[model samples]
Target: MSAGSVPWTDLDSLDIASLARRDGEKWAVAPSGVLPAWVADMDFPISPTIRQAVIRRLDTDLGYPAWFDESHGGPLGEVFARRMLNRYGFVAEPTHVRLFTDINQAMQVILHLGTEPGDGVAFHTPACPPFEDTIGKLGRIPRAVPIRLRDGEWQIDTDRLEDEIRGRQGPPCRALFLVNPHNPTGRVFRRAELLEVAKLAVEYDLMVISDEVHSDLAYPGYEHIPFASLSDEIAERTITLTSGSKAFNLAGARCAIAHIGVKTVRDAVDDHRGVLFGQVSALGVDALKAAWTSSDVWLEHVMAVLSRNRTAVAEQLPPEIGYVPPEATYLAWLDCRGLGLREEEPSDFFLREAKVLLNPGPLFGTEGTGFARLNFATPPRVLDELLRRIRGSLGC
Candidate 1:
């Protein structure tokens, strides 16, 4: 598939009838007439390069994989390191890279190894809902550092965050969960913002689990800086988590990578590698390896569509609803507090009235109240119809 053809034409040409027939969670979970835009998964098709790689792996071998030992320059480490170097100009070591089934699993494993129960974790809230849930289930307290909508931008209150970390006067927050190209709001941290976070981590002696799963999707003029790439001191205190799934639309492939820059956490995770943590499927490895190694041209195509769609969302959305076009990702966070619906909840209101399903704001944390996240990564016609439905529901 030529980069120009697949996204510009083929993606827009996709049939919703055909998409509904597929068993993926994005389309299937919704009722027959409801257009689902709640999930982060893109409506775009997987890259052909990834498909071929998975097929080849299935055709040849299904046995136990060789990279289980987490050796240096192993299946994912070298590939991940090379990708960091080529894509972001960050010099990462193959030896520090590790693999997991998905980002969630990677987080679980890292938290289990890095912190004990009852420790406090400082995370930017209105984040991926599950991160807060994970912190709770693992028996850790959550210190919410909310990024507020100020002056037409989603800016983190760095002062509030520092207070969350330092002013509590109890045990220091053991970990800081950093989500770059932030979810719900889709704000990409500029260099100055990242430096503030790094400074806080250093002052507080906090472990930073930098989640950059959406890093590859940052649009033009928005740069993603790996937290570990800041300085050797910060690197030693950070573990950067990311995946190719979001970029290539391969979430079903279920693979994620982490560069464990801190030696003690790495040693602890390595000491218990196979028994309780750190195992990835052979096919997942192959799929991601192919994606990282060869599917960037496909990504350029997808990014083009997303850039246009992001603009479309800003241009076509109902004037009553407040929306800020995301710096990265195909998701839009809509502020619908002004709508004055009977229920005053945008997701439920839209699902009932517009027949469009969106993720509720409160799921992302209290900061998400009066907000809803809309996935704009669908085919052009489908996206247009949905936006029309939304406008129609508003009686305008």
Candidate 2:
């Protein structure tokens, strides 16, 4: 779709009352009249194509799904392979692509198949909670590599990362959990940065689980370099997990795809699909297919709205709050240390006084203690009210 044809208007214009009635976690988890800017799910409507596809499926009688067969890759796998090639120029064979209910499940499966208990999985600090949580639940150690904010830009401290890999306390570092267009920070990993990570993964003999779910949401002037797409060597050790869920507002749809470059890993995951990993819903599969194959126009429109909202958050937020406009995703990681709250977490303060809910920084990691994550994927009017609430609470 051309930029001009893309609908630049705010589509997520639900008022507080309308939002409360919806069943999304963003709304359901919040009390009545309180704005929910906490979760990563967008407040926007589902893409027309995806919605229609789901509706068509609902008309038919539900039955057992044709499970993803390893011999002949299913339609979802083929579509995902085509999407990777067309969007990111990544060459993925359909046979190597496996379907999952979501990225979280995919990660769990990878951890189970790739590493033994007590193994160390290294990921960047201030990461999305799920990454660390998954590691802990699987009886593994979480090795947090801190990302430093250097000269107003968030950067991976490669030296520190290498040191962490080399000087492990317990179990060997088995995997590197890489988030491209990283959550919270929204720093799109540059080609050079990705190559460095690839080098480290190869050197350390670490399995790379690259989460590129937000790769499609990157803003203009920044590009998301798929970690596995760097080289043949990197691909051999990588399992790239991605989905249209984040970009297309399909979280409830419960569908994700993992492009496995290693044959052994692929086989292990496939073998356990029904026994260890549950089957994906037929509706989710249909929605995913529609999203990847025919919803580019809708995605472009949503991106336009998100791009504008990103700017709005920067321009409208109080000067005391520090925000680096994200290069990808709808989340704006706000540094509230300068707000003079002293001991009070910014998220708690906002929720109590401003009646707006945000993800507290500390929840991401210790590095985010004075920070708060704001979901900017809402209507302009709602965003205005959100800013007003924050400003009023701060007495600005």
Q: Each prediction's Cα lDDT score?
A: 0.86, 0.85
lDDT of 2 by residue, 302-375 (tens): 88888889999988899999999989999999999998898999999999999999999998999999999999
Clash count of each predicted structure: 0, 0
lDDT per residue, candidate 1, 139-252, as tens digits? 888888889888999998899888888747555688999999899788999889899999999998889999999999999998988888898999999999998778877788
Q: What is the overall TM-score of model 2 with all chains considered together? A: 0.95
* Residue-pair clashes, model 1: 0
Candidate 2 lDDT (Cα, whole model)?
0.85
Worst 10 residues of 2 by lDDT: 1-10
lDDT of 1 at 100: 79
Instruction: Return the TM-score for candidate 1, rounded to 2 decimals.
Output: 0.96
For each candidate, give its TM-score against the true structure: 0.96, 0.95
